[model samples]
Target: MLFEDEKTNSEIAKMLHIGETTFYKWKNNPKFIKAQHEYAVYQFDSALPLAVKTLIEILKYGKSDKVRLQAAQIIFKRAGLFSDNGNPELDKAKQRKAIA
Candidate 1:
């Protein structure tokens, strides 16, 4: 139930014909938590191949320069290749200085 769908605690409890407190108790069980984390990691890892493929397509054939730049930025940031996703006020200051 947890791995297959992204359901809220309440929804999952209702689906299982249980109360929310009982659901939380089961959710917080150590084995259940471990399994949950493992399942989430598996899901994330499984998606990476498709994500990389789409990112490559965007870099190569995106219609707009803005989108291609965004794709390149994603690749660079993931590679620790430096990006300025920094303080907005600092960015504005830099922009003003450039204009001046």
Candidate 2:
């Protein structure tokens, strides 16, 4: 509900017919955590640059290449580079395999 009109926590709780306590509890749920994380990214503001940077670092150094790629995609999209026409560099990179 944060997107439609940027509803607050209380508003969301009322809309979902739940108490504030219940809503807080839901915040700790794994599914809710994932959704909230995405929502936070979508609604991110300039003041959140540090948090974004931290996430990028985690993605860059994290164990999973998949996670790192996902983070890179998010960062690129947020920076307005990933467009409807797609990214040429990304396409080319995907077509080429690294020799290790």
Best by TM-score: 1
Can you give the lDDT of residue 31 in candidate 2? 93
Candidate achieving the largest lDDT: 1
Please give me the total number of clashing residue pairs in predicted model 2. Answer: 0
Local distance difference test values of all predictions, in order: 0.84, 0.73
Instruction: Give the poorly placed runs of model 2, Cα more than 4 Å off.
Output: 1-47, 84-100
Q: For each candidate, how many residue pairs have backbone atoms clashing (under 3 Å)?
A: 0, 0
* TM-score of candidate 1 versus the correct structure, residues matched by position: 0.66
Model 2 scores a TM of: 0.37
Q: What lDDT does candidate 2 reach at residue 14? A: 98
